[model samples]
Target: MIEAGKKIILFDGVCNLCNNAINFVIKRDKNDVFRYASLQSEIGKKLIAERNIDISKIDSILLIDPKIAYYHKSTAALQISKQLSGIYPLLSVFLVVPQSLRDWVYDIIAKNRYKWFGKKESCMIPTPELKALFIDQ
Candidate 1:
């Protein structure tokens, strides 16, 4: 189980886009604010069940703050960006655009993600070097 304090990012395990995004966040996470779990994993499923999240309706990305609560969709993305290093924090300016509009775009991309980015036969297996950053390695 993930300890208190860090954020846990739950993502579609087989998704190429999601995997790449994880790598992106890892590279920029100078403050070490995040951990990860594939949404298909036992731990990820437990988190979803504990939060009463409906997987059929929301299976993209989830940001579980562990201390606070959870966030999804564009809110999760923007919140994660706000904690990153360099110019990423500036992307929070998009928060002023209105959530409905922002999520609409996010939804479109999420809906077509597999088609556009392809998928692995199974969930990604983190390299040995990155294992500590994952919840269920």
Candidate 2:
């Protein structure tokens, strides 16, 4: 389980796009507000099961704000963006759009992510320096 104040990011392990996004977040995580876990990992699975998240319906990015709540799909991405440094937080302005519309777009990209971006044979192994950023690496 995550600590009370920290946020958790659950991502697809083998998806190249997901790994790249993790790297991007790590670079901009100036205050280290996030920790990560692949959806296939033990903690990831336990969290999902506790929340009763149906993978068939929503299997991609998920953000858990420990005691607060969990966010999925475009909301998760935009919420994450709001936590990053630089111009990225501006992306949360898109939240004014309807969630259904935003999720529609997110779904399209998620569905085709593997076909468009490909996948790795296994989950990324965090380097020693980054190991602390991941819970179940």
Candidate 3:
């Protein structure tokens, strides 16, 4: 279960691009507002089922704000950026760009992510110091 005030990020575990993005977020998570789970993990599958998310449609990233709401694709990315340190929050301005346009671009990148960035055979294993920040690892 998610703790109060914590947001959960569910990502493609074997994706290099997704893994790099998570590392970037971890470095800027000054507020410690995030917890992570690989989409391939049991907890990730459970959360997806609980939310009734159709991963067949959107299979990249997801942001779960506990009982409040959940977000996917570009909306999820922008929302996560807004909570990070430095000027990353400014990325939220793209929210007004229209969801259709935003998702079109997201789809292009996601479709090519594996070919462009490659992938690992298995999910990333969090280091000892970072283990507490992850769930279902």
Candidate 1 residue lDDT tens string, 1-65:
67668999999999999999999999999999999999999999999999999988777899999
Whole-model lDDT, model 2:
0.92
* Global local distance difference test of model 3: 0.95
Please provide, for model 3 over 9-38, each residue's C-alpha lDDT reduced to its tens digit, 9 standing for 90 to 100.
999999999999999999999999999999
Highest lDDT model number: 3
TM-score of 3: 0.97
Which wins on TM-score, candidate 1 or candidate 3? Answer: 3
lDDT at 32 for candidate 3? 96
For all predicted structures, in order, the TM-scores are: 0.96, 0.96, 0.97
Candidate order (lDDT): 3, 1, 2
Winner on lDDT (1 vs 3): 3
Q: Compute the lDDT of residue 95 as modeled in candidate 1.
A: 92
